[model samples]
Target chain A: MRCQQVRRAWLEPELSAKARRHMQACPACQREWELNRRLNEAFSGWEVERPLPAEWDRRLQQRIATARTGWRGWLESWRWRPHPQPLRLAAGALLLLLVAGAGLYVRPRWFSPRAVKPASTGIVRDLQALNQNQEILQCPLFAGHGAGDLANGAENMN
Target chain B: MVIEDRLTGRLKLSADVLDADAEQMLRFQAGDETAFEILVQRYRRPLSGYMDRMLQNSPVSDELTQEAFLRVYLSRRRYRPTARFSTWLYRIATRLALNYLRDHRHERRQLSLDQPSPVTERPPEAASPAPGQEGEMLADERCRRIRRSVAALPERQRTAVILHKYQEMDYRAIGETLQISVNATKSLLFRAYETLRRELRDLEEAR
Candidate 1:
């Protein structure tokens, strides 16, 4: 195999057996392999020597706290805002009570027999009182000198 | 079993740590403050080193590592235990580091080399005519040149190479962390290796 092909296949260890056989016969491929292996080792050795700063943990903790607080604050805001669940329940209960009370208050209008009779009686009495007042007003005794006119008019007044 | 044995067992099993990490995340989601602290202490160093390589700057890596952890904490409620917690955490750190690099693109490349490097002013190696020992010396010089060359690669390739070689993460894990397809992850590694091979031609010639 060519060096390029060998390098590509090197990442997969299963191909190592085939690559080794090919590398033995191929001098150019051997040189490329050696160079790549050496390069890999050197690159791996370029260690990052620095440690994390002293205050990093403290700062990270503070940030964590801030974020936690922010999240809680958001949830708390939602909680304080009128929850639709409770609001709907309360409104429904109120509507139910108002309907019930109205039903009780108006039951007599539909179901009370005496209510019908009293209304008719009161209207009839008002009508009779009106007729009586009309008769008295027409009587000559109620006003000026129409007494003779009234007795004369009484037979026709009916 | 005794408590001591149980504790020892728990500590000994690496898988238990994975489970514990997942549990800690759950606790954190449930508003456990101490769980967050445990998580921070558990991952601080490995994450720091990983971030250092990703960002290639110590202080910035430090800052961003903290930011990544904080982000993880803030997103605790979103955590799912399907993947390992470290994998998830590293994913966050990698993304934050990549963003940092993108944001700081205009800044000059600054090596936080604390003191004089051992081989400060070493001249470039030439392809020499001599034989045996010269071959070894040339090989050494080639290796150094290769490191410098790989480090000079574009950020994505560099990251792919670093994760593949240094972190020893598989293509699947890398894909998840990079938010790319597994095939794309392999392609990234392939391209990175191709670039490294081409760029290190000097080292190849020296041999």
Candidate 2:
């Protein structure tokens, strides 16, 4: 139990009197204490020694300045601008409604019967003409007829 | 009138001392440009060190640190005083570091053994005893082994250990940064420390 307490203390570092006494007496706990200390030292030793580049501030400032002047800056500035929250929300909702309404209004025009009728009629007329020619070609009277006879027959039908 | 002015100035000073980071963020959000410089000065070193340790490359660390700051700057309008400013900043840095690690995992695995460990660049300045040069060498080898063991830890455990031990974050803050629960953060640190203890036990025994 003392050994377990010592191990827990190694992690939490809130040692009680019993754990402290155990650590002092037990060679194993003493070793564990030393190991914990070394681990901490290793971590501290990894501290960054190199300074940031001298131009870092200047470059960052320049970038920020440029950003403020560009289109991104415009967008961000507009984004950050203070406005009443409820007003902004209402505006957003209104914009969404407008967009949805426009989409809905435009949708039927694209697929409306009036818009489709002309092209559909042209297709039907071509199909009818094709069917008439096919029927005429299959007719027994026109089966062995020459071009002149076929034209005469077509004229008569017209 | 003068007494009232003095009281206002004292109150401002007290607020600055008590919550300087969040105060500065508020100031910057309100279009006070110089407040940002104060924030940059404050966070630059710690954030850079955190990145350096996580990525194991000083140059990349420098770049990512700059990027993190820029992100803060760019998103200034989105800043809220809901959490500690340091916690938010760390969340950004941690995310950047984790993304970099994930993307470069394959490249990191192929690193040459000839390359030096990325933990520390300079050797300790202490002079070794002339007769104990061999002992000094062994100690150096042990330190190297310890570094490798730490670097070999799984990503979440490594992150937890770094945040808890190195950054000195409380479990709650670490959990917030990692987007985990506080209990999970504690569990992660426990597992990580256990792994470190096992890996470095030989060095302890040798001594």
Q: Could you say which candidate leads in lDDT?
A: 2
Q: List the candidate 2 regions with Cα displacement exceeding 4 Å.
A: A1-9, A16-31, A69-94, A113-158, B1-18, B122-129, B132-139, B203-207
Quote model 1's TM-score: 0.61
lDDT of 1 at B175: 80
Question: Which candidate number maximizes DockQ?
Answer: 2
Per-residue lDDT tens digits for candidate 2, residues A93-157, read 89999999999999998878653445557889899999998898788976788778868978999
Model 1: per-residue Cα lDDT over A1-158, one tens digit each: 67667767766657777788888888877766665676686666656666567777777767666765786535533342222467757877899999999999999888876534455578899999999977887786667645577687788988
Restricted to chain B, the TM-score per model reads: 0.71, 0.81
Tens digit of per-residue lDDT, candidate 1, span B1-207: 332343355334344344778777766766677888898888887777777666655777788878888778666656656667877887888888777777877662565323223322244445565667676575555555555655567777777777777677888778877878888887888778767766566545655
lDDT per residue for candidate 2 within B1-207, as digits (tens), equals 432343355334443323568778777876787898999999898888788778888778888888888878888877755567888899999999989999999998999643665546545435655776876565565566556666778887888888887789888889988999987887787777666766678766676
Please report the candidate that would top TM-score against the real structure: 2
Q: Which stretches of candidate 1 lie over 4 Å from their true place?
A: A1-3, A70-158, B1-18, B109-147, B204-207
Superposition error at B104 for model 2 (Å): 0.9
lDDT of 2 at A136: 83
